[model samples]
Target: MKKIILTLFTAIAVLALAACSSTSGASKDKEITLGATAGPYTDMVNKAIKPSLEKKGYKVKVVEFSDYIQPNLALSKGDLDANLFQHKVYMENFAKEKNLKLSEVVVVPTAPMGLYSNKFKSIEEIKEGSTLAIPNDPVNLARTLIMLKDAGLITIKEDTNQLTASEKDIKDNPKNLNFKPLEAAQLPRAVQSADVAAVPGNFALAAKMDLLDALQLENMPDTYRNRVVVNTKDLESAFAKDIKEVVESKEFEEVIDKEFKGFGKPEWMKK
Candidate 1:
């Protein structure tokens, strides 16, 4: 009876050890969830990032958001492991406002902003006093103004920092064009009603407006390129490192070239 009882206890101990070992393995392989907006950002992860990570035995989950605000919120709240939908300036401004500790993992390709007009086929055709729609947000409004300045439709004040310029900062409106500051998301629809609309690349892609159709486009500096961002704490983690590798890989460059044709320029090619 003593021998049989000792044998049963040993078997139970072995089973418990096995169960603990199995749980540990499962925890190590937990799927990582990344947040992004619905257009090219999501497409890049689903088409390129996912497969690349999966090949290395990691399962990646991509969560899509429509607006620009929520992905950062999600990442800050620990709902997402990382995100790839925002530019460096936008991310810095957002983190400062929200008091969130965040950092960039990599700078991916950029989707350059453009001036699109259905009413006028060319920038020269845009007449004086034409109501032009620009983004209401501070950073993007400034970006829009710079693009217009470059296109010679308007001139921004020489003293003002062009990156954050607002309608108040316009030094000259050559045609005396009317400026309508609307929500960035609404600019695509505004293109139909407004004589000229300045649209961000992502919003344009979401609205299916071809960049080639824009009368003028801005090939912005590297500071404006989209980034893969994570909570500052995770910047050195295995998952974050994998994400950086995947985004900077040749395969990802191909995705940018194929799916986003005229929209994104490869990071290496950035001036």
Candidate 2:
């Protein structure tokens, strides 16, 4: 009799454990956490994405990081369900270097990188040999050089891409421009001293710099569009699909227009 009682108790305990495990997994699936660097990314998620997800019966959490590294790391470590702050090229490079399984879930709008000035009012007004501050990092430096080329202040080699372009890649400098490379974070502050500073979109938005005041804005390529990134495994999941649909919806576009006036429409949306 005692043996029968023990067997029954063991069966009940096993069932209870399995039930608890199943419930935990189900709860996890119902909640989604997204990570992004503080600023535009956070603004988009909070002002737009969060409400969309919550309406679909998911509890959404937006985790804000102050720098580039932590968001990707957190997402990879399963601390975040997704992230929304990197270009595909940058994320691909980072994933390759870190051996992460990250992939782009959706392409968000291309925030046009712009040349902000404290001294010059227009690109033509920028005098010859004027020191222009650019992001020292390779990707942004290359992009800034391209924008300067388009502005006719300088010309980069046609063969150059953002990764390979440098001061030496300047095929011509009509303005006899003096280039100063500084940390991207410092470009906003540097504009006070430098004649013109090539600032990335997020940084400009964070600094509350007026986009209309920019001397020139880069025509963002499809490749430069910001993305919603996630674990490769999550790319096909229903939760991810819902999130993608929400961002690509008309409501989301309205938020984009209302929140980011000068930030141009995304190429994917052009379809």
lDDT (CA) per prediction: 0.86, 0.86
Predicted candidate 1 versus true structure: per-residue lDDT over 40-133, tens digit per residue:
8888779868888888777688999988899999999999999988888889989999999999998877678899988898999999899999
Which TM-score value belongs to model 1? 0.82
Clashing pairs in 1: none
Model 2: number of clashes?
0
Give one digit per residue, the lDDT tens place, for model 2 in 1-271: 9999999999999999999999888767789998888887798899878998888878888899998899999999999999988887889889999999888888887578899887878888988889988999888887888888888888777787665688889888887888888999898898899988999888888888887678999877767778899999999999889989999999999998888777866777888
Listing every candidate in turn, what is its Cα RMSD in Å to the true structure after a full C-alpha superposition?
4.7, 6.0
Worst 10 residues of 2 by lDDT: 155-164
lDDT for model 1: 0.86
Taking all chains together, each candidate's TM-score versus the true structure is 0.82, 0.85
Query: Candidate 1: where are CA atoms >4 Å away?
Result: 1-27
